[model samples]
Target: MFLPNPDAEFTGSYERCGLTLKEYQELIKLSLDSRTFLVKQSKQSAFAKLDLYGFKDEMVFLSGSSDNIELLHEIMADYGEDVNQWYQPFTSRIRHIRAMKSQSQYHTQTQTDVFEIA
Candidate 1:
């Protein structure tokens, strides 16, 4: 049994609350699309940037948002198949776990990039 989030239109910036779910979803999709392009353009594994700080700014920014937090939780509940891209709002270690598990095959080296906030 599951209950969805309240469906109110959010007028504040992401720092305050959230935009409408549709708008937030669109922004997330755009971020994911850009992430895909980055992976391809850099010739790196999807998890490669996690080992480095390539998208660190974006990740940090997303992590700071109340809207991103709620949106990610909503997404995880309603559409888990799209979970990998939701890692932007998580810590690096959590991001690594989700990224690895998202793939059909796991790589050992991906474990070396566990970034704890301490």
Candidate 2:
């Protein structure tokens, strides 16, 4: 699971989902060349998050710049399979996703030399 407060509330709609910086760049290049590009965002947001990162792809929630049509289409991978959901903050936690066997309510050390006792 993506850690560092994985509990952050997020929408499950891929319509307004995020795209990695690289993906955005690629989208721009394609647009400049007048080409259409598609992204793998059909899966539910929750599952897609896992799938995207699981496949070693980075995500970037670029809805903040949706005002610009170029930016919106750049990051939008799909039209969404369902009604739009509330916008979710791009909390930015791409470094915590990993392959593990099980998960539970637990905490990890903040530092190897020193630990936060709270």
Candidate 3:
């Protein structure tokens, strides 16, 4: 699961990921400060293109393995109740994405080819 800064200037025009800039920064700081393996901060840059309308110079990204719900829970525990407000929406999006992926996979058809040798 990946979360971007909601308060980021460019984020307003696009889908919000439910995290404030302060919260996003703090999360990254926490991981760095503690040198924990559960979470890591990544910096991403988006280039302007005709197809992409919203582009940010530098974006903060935080992610944990899809199977690792504990990573998110641990962060929430550290941040206390304040994080609960945005947690639901964030997790909801993740669940929705997962559902979509599973549905697509179920509906997709696969083809195999065989060759005969003389």
Best prediction by TM-score: 3
Q: Candidate 1: TM-score?
A: 0.21
Tell me the TM-score of model 3.
Answer: 0.26
What's model 2's TM-score?
A: 0.19
Q: Give the alpha carbon lDDT tens digit for every residue of 20-90 in model 2.
A: 43443443443223324434444412211112334332233433333333433432434432324211211
TM-score head-to-head 1 vs 2, winner: 1
TM-scores vs. true structure, each candidate: 0.21, 0.19, 0.26
Between which residue pairs do clashes occur in model 3?
Answer: none
Off by over 4 Å in 1: 1-53, 56-62, 81-118
Residue 6 lDDT in candidate 1: 33
For 14-112, candidate 1 gives per-residue lDDT tens digits of 214423445434334443323322122222222222233576546645465675566557656654645465454345545665577777354653556
- How far out, in Å, is residue 31 in model 2? 3.1
Q: What is each predicted model's overall lDDT from 0 to 1?
A: 0.43, 0.32, 0.44
Which of the predicted structures, 1 or 3, would earn the higher lDDT when compared with the native? 3
